[model samples]
Target: MGFDQYHEPPNELPDEVRTFARMILSLIEEAQAIDWYEQRMAVEKDKEAKAIMRNAQKEEFKHFGMDLEFLLRRKPQWREILQGILFQDGDIVEHGEEAEEAVD
Candidate 1:
């Protein structure tokens, strides 16, 4: 499709960099799909339509998670930071600050 993901010349980018850019774009698209489905479900009148939208949104959520996991695997520092921040009980901002400090 479009090569809008590349800020620099795509021809100059290594294959890995190009692949990373593609994954980033996929992550963004998945997030946008989730948001669109949320808005659509909110105003939808038909029960069946809302149910379908909800299902589609769940699929988008899974895709988003997969994309995030893939990117995180490529960035160990990011993974380390998120480990301290995700799924733990505490002040979120505090957790984020602690995670950032830990990484640093």
Candidate 2:
């Protein structure tokens, strides 16, 4: 191996960037959950099942891109809160409860 091909270290992300990343990751998880729900609901043979899934999918897509836009816009605090909710280390229920409390 030659020293001519040294690998560069990844850049250190600011707190805002980290938060945005986490938020996007969470949105992805939510989308996956919606997909799972849609699949489960499909087994019921209900006519509205497909419509529900389609709407959920559309909302997921919107949120996914919205999170990206927030990151791009450097809305750090909002991103931080969103990330806190998304990557709650398996404490989604608690995070949601806290979010609700915070809103009040």
Candidate 3:
């Protein structure tokens, strides 16, 4: 079987790199799940169904966060750049620009 998450052959990739790729795939899946729930909930007629979707979406959020944190721990540059952009008020693009420039 082939895995799209890996650019190189999985067997040739080191254990850590393979694990990172798996987590990246997991994060993407979780984000997709969250988006799917949002779309379903928006048009859902039943209040009970909407509530269930929202609860499921929250679990996806946690999974995404855990995946992101794991990746960031292994990539210092990523952690550095996001620190300037995430959870901060004001212009996001400007913060991203500043973060990128700071890394240089």
Candidate 4:
């Protein structure tokens, strides 16, 4: 019954680190749920079922966002890097490169 999220011994890790690991795991789960719903909706023949899947997928998206935001709020540098890349209209790769450079 050991948790796979912690790379190190859980007892040795601080509470904040443990919480961070939990949030990271939660984020991963939410992303997986979103992907699962996407695949399900793609293959689903019933329109109503597809619509319900879409709705559920949207909820997963929200949860993913919340989890990401929680982690980012704790990591200022990460948030700074993301700020330069997210919601920008320019080239994504270029933005990422610039963001990395700016942070360095």
TM-score of 4: 0.96
Model 1 quality (TM-score):
0.95
Candidate of highest lDDT: 4
Arrange candidates by lDDT, descending. Answer: 4, 1, 3, 2
What are the lDDT figures for the candidates, one per model?
Answer: 0.96, 0.64, 0.94, 0.97
Give the winner by TM-score.
Answer: 4
Candidate 3 backbone overlaps, count? 0
Candidate 4 Cα misplacement greater than 4 A, ranges: none
The digit string of per-residue lDDT tens for model 3 on 6-38 reads: 889888999999999999999999999999999
Off by over 4 Å in 2: 1-14, 41-44, 71-104
Worst 10 residues of 2 by lDDT: 1-10
Better of 1 and 2 by lDDT: 1
RMSD for all candidates, in order, please.
Answer: 1.3, 13.3, 0.9, 0.9
lDDT of 2 by residue, 40-67 (tens): 6667576687678767767876776776
Candidate 3 lowest-lDDT run of ten: 1-10
